[model samples]
Target: MRIGELGNETGVDIETIRHYEKIGLLSVPPREPNGYRNYETSHLERLAFIRHCRALDMPLADVKRLLDFITHPEVDCGEINRLIDAHLHNIRERLHSMQSLEKQLEVLRARCGDSHIVRDCGILSELVAASHKTGVKKD
Candidate 1:
């Protein structure tokens, strides 16, 4: 099949398919007689794998590393374990930061629960005061 057929099958776009090829994530397929690319079964499988990894929010470089491990299945998988652990740690850190941000926003929101004109808005006053304290440059 061609690029479009492969994209439809994998739910990936044409440009992303081309980018994978360009970045060596997906193998380049042979061109047909009329210069159209002739993608085979392997291309379909590989593209699906890439799409799955991306859906998991795995980094492209980590996906490439995982691909390398595929070629040498007998090697120790300790690195893969470490990579996943690191990714999990980063996610936990972000979740913590987000929770903190939510708390701060909640406090700020409580300051102006009642409707007020722009001049009397507690939220706007707090924001402007905080910005000045942080030395935010006014353009």
Candidate 2:
């Protein structure tokens, strides 16, 4: 089939499919005699795999690494496990940071209870004071 057909089968955009080819994430298919790019079932499968990895929020570099591993099944999987563990650690760190941010926002929200104009808002006052302490004058 053609690029569009392959894209439809894999649910990937044309540009994304092209981008994957350009970025070495997907192999470029051979062209037909009429010069149309010819894609096969293997292309569909690889595109789906790429899309799944992207949906998992895997970085492109990691996706490439994973693809390399997929292509070389004989390789040991210990490194793959290590990579996943590292990614999990990074995710945990981000979660912790987000929780801290939520706590900070909760404190800021609590500073302004139900009633106050912008000028009298405790949250704004605290922000202004904190900004001044940090040498950032808020207008």
Best by TM-score: 1
Over 34-66, each residue of candidate 1 has an lDDT whose tens digit, in order, gives 999999999999899989988988899989998
Candidate 2, residues 31-88: lDDT per residue as tens digits? 9999999998889899999999888888999999999999899999999999899888
Q: Rate the local accuracy (lDDT) of all candidates.
A: 0.93, 0.92
Residue pairs with backbone overlap in model 2: none
Candidate 2's displacement at residue 74, Å, is: 1.2
lDDT of 2 at 16: 94
Model 1: colliding residue pairs: none
Cα misplacement distance, residue 7 of candidate 2 (Å): 3.5
Name the lDDT value of residue 35 in candidate 1.
100
